[model samples]
Target: MHTIEIQKEPVELYKILKFEGMTSTGGEAKLLIGDGQVTVNGETETRRRRKMMNGDVIGFRGDQFHLQLSTHTETI
Candidate 1:
């Protein structure tokens, strides 16, 4: 399991995948999501643009990630 911290409340699923280096490119992230290779909270998620938030657990390629809001407290 790994942790990914996002500064914003809601992030697009594909962006998270790409940001976390789970996929080499944005296109690959989209393809992986569209192919049902991603899961959220243990359920398969196929929406490429699904909104992801804090506490959301994402699973892909046998790896799990727990999303956390960055504690920087700076207004974006």
Candidate 2:
């Protein structure tokens, strides 16, 4: 299981996949999600724009990721 920390809550599913290098591009991520190649909390997730929040478990291509909300906030 891999841990992914998000600075904010409710990130879009496809953005996560693309930003995390799961897919080369956002379009690919969307296609993959649409093809039922992704899961959330152990259930298949097909919504490319699915809102992923803290503690959400995502599965893709046999790999698992645990989403964690970053508690540290940066101040200037």
Candidate 3:
């Protein structure tokens, strides 16, 4: 299982797919998601803009990923 650290909460499904290099482009990511080729927490997710947060698992192309929220600290 691969771990991905996200800087914030509520990341879009397509964005994650694209940003993570799962898809070449955002459009491709959206297409794959719209075609029901993606899963969230082992369940099929077709929402292109599905809001994902920490602890969400994404499955695609037989690859699984675990999302983790990065602890951002403010510097004085």
Q: Which candidate is the best by TM-score?
A: 2
lDDT of 1 at 66: 97
Q: How high a TM-score does candidate 1 get? A: 0.93
Whole-model lDDT values for every prediction: 0.95, 0.97, 0.96
Cα error, candidate 3, residue 2 (Å): 0.4
Model 3: lDDT equals 0.96
**RMSD, every candidate, angstroms:** 1.7, 0.5, 1.1
lDDT of 1 by residue, 1-50 (tens): 89999999799999999988888999999999999999999999999999
Off by over 4 Å in 2: none
Question: What is the lDDT ranking, best to worst?
Answer: 2, 3, 1
Cand. 2 Cα-lDDT: 0.97
The TM-score ranking, best first, is 2, 3, 1
Where model 3 places Cα greater than 4 Å from the true spot, the runs are 74-76
C-alpha TM-scores of all predictions? 0.93, 0.98, 0.94
Per-residue CA lDDT of model 3 for 6-49, tens digit only, reads: 99999999999999999999999999999999999999999999
Candidate 1 structure lDDT: 0.95
